[model samples]
Target: MPGAREELIAHITEKAVFHGDFILTSGKQASFYVDLRRVSLDHRVAPLIGQVMLDLIAGVPGVSAVGGLTMGADPIAAAILHQGAARGVPLDAFVVRKEPKDHGRGRQVEGPDVAGRRVIVVEDTSTTGGSPLKAIAALEKVGAEIAAVAVVVDRATGAREVIEAAGYPYLAALDLADLGLEA
Candidate 1:
């Protein structure tokens, strides 16, 4: 896992992270940014994300499914779902849209039905836990038992407290310190 950690950190540092002044999705300003999608969608690196994430969540006891908010969570969920299959473990994937689709079934939760399932929300990076927390709220509305919350990179903001305050364990594959960008 150390190797995986090192490799991902290097890949992210070289390809995804930017050291500069910018505003984040959460309306917060930062000296750096981590655009994990740069690496999350890559054919080669996606599996590494999946494997490392899957390894972290493997012992959660009853995770029948994994997913999170859209855009960012899309690839992470897909990769983990696929990687889980390759590892002889079947796990479903779901997405929590910004709002329920205006047409069709008009469901906010997409993909497999998550009702009564043990779900772990996933994300590419967590700043304030806003997006994943939104996903958790949506999933809870549908009766999905959130086993935990997982992130590829945790900026070590208040996300840990925010997520745990919502009553679920927060799991991070990497953190600001891990990326050598400790706050």
Candidate 2:
């Protein structure tokens, strides 16, 4: 897990997944960024990420499944489910919609039935942690027990306090400091 985390950190630093000063969702801007899909699409990083995330939250009690909001959670969930099967742990995966649909099945939670199951939300990066919290509300509304939350990187914007205040442990494989970017 440590090696995989290190590899991810190295990739992010060297590749510099950044561009011009851009406005973040929080309307704040600096000189750096991390478009995780770049790493998520890399076959090597993808699988290694799955292993690392799984290990990070393995000690969280329950955890029958894994997932988060659609686009961000997609790759992580798939990787974790696949690797979990390989290791014989067999975790289910699901996606929480940004908004509940009004047509067809009219579902907000997609993939598997999360009701009565223990779940964890995953994020590629967390600044204020709003995205995962939205998923958490949707999941718990459907009766899923949230055991913890994990992120590949913490953008150092009080995410830990926000999540912990809501009574969920926030786990991170790397913070900005680990990448040599101070909080």
lDDT of each: 0.90, 0.84
Model 1 TM-score (2 dp): 0.95
- Please give the clash total of every predicted structure, in order: 0, 0
Q: Note each model's CA RMSD in angstroms.
A: 1.5, 1.9
Model 2 lDDT at residue 89 = 85
What is the lDDT for 30 in model 2? 60
Query: Which run of 10 residues does model 2 get worst, by summed lDDT?
Result: 14-23
Top-TM-score candidate index? 1
**Candidate 1, run of 10 with poorest lDDT:** 1-10
Candidate 1 residue lDDT tens string, 1-183: 467657777888889988989887778789999999999999878988998899899889988999999989999999999999999999999999999989998899998999999999999988888998899889999999999999999887789899998788999998887777856
lDDT of 2: 0.84
